[model samples]
Target: MEAPPVIAVVGPTGSGKSDLAVSLALELDGEVINADSMQFYRGMDIGTAKITEAERRGVPHHLLDILDVTEEASVSDFQQQARALIADIHGRGKRAILAGGSGLYVRAALDVLEFPGTDPQIRRRLEAELEAAGPAPLRQRLEAVDPVSAGRLGDARRIIRALEVFELTGRTFSSFMPAREYYQPAVQIGLDVDRELLRERLARRVHAMVDRGLLEEARRLDAAGLRKGRTAPRALGYAQFLKVLDGTASVAEAAEETVVATRQFARRQLTWFRADPRVSWLDWQDPGLVARATGLCRTVPVQPLA
Candidate 1:
């Protein structure tokens, strides 16, 4: 018998991918495997807009809260762990639902991507460069060597890691990127929304996160060494509010920055998912979204999802 099809719900943040994933899981008798990198860290609840237990509605969620604030979440590690989790879920005769708007993490979990090995010495040297000279110079160096990788790497940690990959392997980091190929038999459902409406929604979502104690959560994580986390520190709300905790910005200012940053992040995510022609697009606000997504999943011969 053929393996069960892996289901992926992907879109920009605030596009309701999480809720859709839950609906898909319920209809398909599936389990959710989180692809959001920020949600990987514990104590990052409010800032990450992590779903509460009640919101989960009894579905088992894997790969969430598996890392402390101090640990860097590695895409390579997630790829290995998530594939194993998906295999286990498949072995149990259940479908695996990959959920999150995090483009790279989602791709890492479901794509035929390869992670280049890291050399400790080279990583240390590149990280030292990032610390002493900051991201500007390192990014400039990455641009000189690998413009494609440099363009995709927005954070200091990723920039440093890409540089390290170049130095250690003598190959451009982009060379390792997977061809538009799936790691398994999978169907990806993408949510579509008006850009202006999405911007409005993202702004409102940031304000709601603040109202829900994102600031207080950031403060707690600060005491718990959030700044030490290379990946977590670069997350949307956490980075903005860390400025608030550092006395560099007011709570309102931080929240506003988070809104703007999140909107830009959403645009990037949409671009990433849209580039793949295989994804079936659905109007996010459709009245029968759940029904439509379910039908797409159950369709045989895998008709293109629109």
Candidate 2:
């Protein structure tokens, strides 16, 4: 028998992707591999809306809570880990369901993507330049050589990495972007939602998280050196609540800020997934969402293992 195609449940945050993925896993005899970058950190449950053990419904989950809050989240590392899990699941004659909203990480695992090699020396020099001069000068330099990357990237770290790639490979970073072609036979099911409803839902969810002790969680993680981390400290709720930890903001203010940031993040996620024509979008609130997603998974084109 041919192997089952990998199933990816994708969409904006709080769009029911996780629940749908869990249902699909149960229906399709699959295990889930997380693609949500924020969920990878230990003790980040409430802020990240991580699925609880009871919510997992006996389905196996991979790659959650695998990183310390102090470590950087690496897309390349996830690419390797997720691919290996998919292969192992396939070898056991089970389906591999990739679930989450991290667009680049999802693409890194499923698409025909290559991670460019990095040079530490080149990166250090760029970082030094970034420290001496702000990102404006480096941004201008990147714009001259790779305008696409410059326009797409907002943060100094990503900008520095793009410049490092250019210096190391003499090629534009955008040139390495993956085409939509799948690395393996796969199907992506995107959960679509009403924007206004989702925005409200996000706000409510943020408030619920705060009620569930997001501020306390943030305090615990902050004591664990969350502020020292490059990535974890910047996650939506955690970042805002850290202000609460230092007395710079009230819990109410942090909760409001987290809601705004999460809503904005969801918008970006929607924009990212919507750009991929390969994804089969389903109404997030559809009563039969699992059935529809399962049907889509069943029809995935057959291809040999990579």
Candidate 3:
């Protein structure tokens, strides 16, 4: 009669969290709720490394392929949807496994975090500033207002959002860091790999994606309005390949850039997850990882709904 605890599998992009989530799901009688923002788009499979049906191993996955390339993904919207799905999954007496490398999305799903509302006019104005002046000045403004978020945010889109949050809420975005409390009973399992080894693996993975027609995929999506997509077009592999199609880079150049970018992104993912003391880390290559994670899940204290 007790409610089940939520288990989150989080880590760097290439750390095999999805496979491990499937293993844990099989062991714990759970379904996966994707926390990867990029994987939400239907046609972004190859670039996002979305799991194939065969790879899902019969464990139901949620929140994936639910968006089109044209529609922007909002973490606030996702937070609402994911919490409801977790409640539904729990109501059905199955544990919910939150899986993905996107740190904010993972936190939004399980942590006691609240999203601030956005103002369209303010957003348009900031975006205009970004277009007129580029990201450096906006980043400088963010550094003046919200240095912590400015330090962490590397892209123009996110930098603009942070500034917008400060302007709209009159509070710095980083000041809203979620307390260690969970919205529901939850546990986080983090996966890790050695830096040099992970770099090699990521490079190989990018090459493999190119071999699997990443260029072709990007081209198809491009003709389908990828350029107009505020978010989807800026995703990792998609952005690089867009350069290839633009004649600004070669396919090989794009692949190499993707490898480098993904490696840096993996490091950022590690830093973000490692900051939270609640996450228990395991080596991705551990042979007994599933059993270990199963034990951890069983022992984690279940907090009543908050």
Task: Give the candidate number with the greatest lDDT.
Answer: 2
lDDT of 2 by residue, 236-294 (tens): 99988888878899988988888888999999999999999999999998888888888
Tens-digit lDDT track of model 1 for 94-142? 7789999888888888788888887889988887887787889998999
Off by over 4 Å in 3: 303-306
Worst 10 residues of 2 by lDDT: 297-306
Local accuracy of candidate 3 as per-residue lDDT tens digits, 1-306: 567788999999888999999999999899999999999998999998999999999999999999889999999999999999998888788999999999988889888898998989999999999999899999999999999998888888888888888999999999888577787778899986888888898899999999999999999999889888888988999999999999999998999999989998999899999999999888888999999999989987765543
- Which is superior by lDDT, 1 or 2? 2
Of models 1 and 3, which has the larger TM-score?
3
Residue 126 local lDDT, model 2: 93
Q: Give lDDT per model, in order.
A: 0.87, 0.92, 0.90
Q: Measured by C-alpha RMSD in angstroms, how accurate is candidate 3?
A: 1.7
Reference-based TM-score, model 3: 0.94
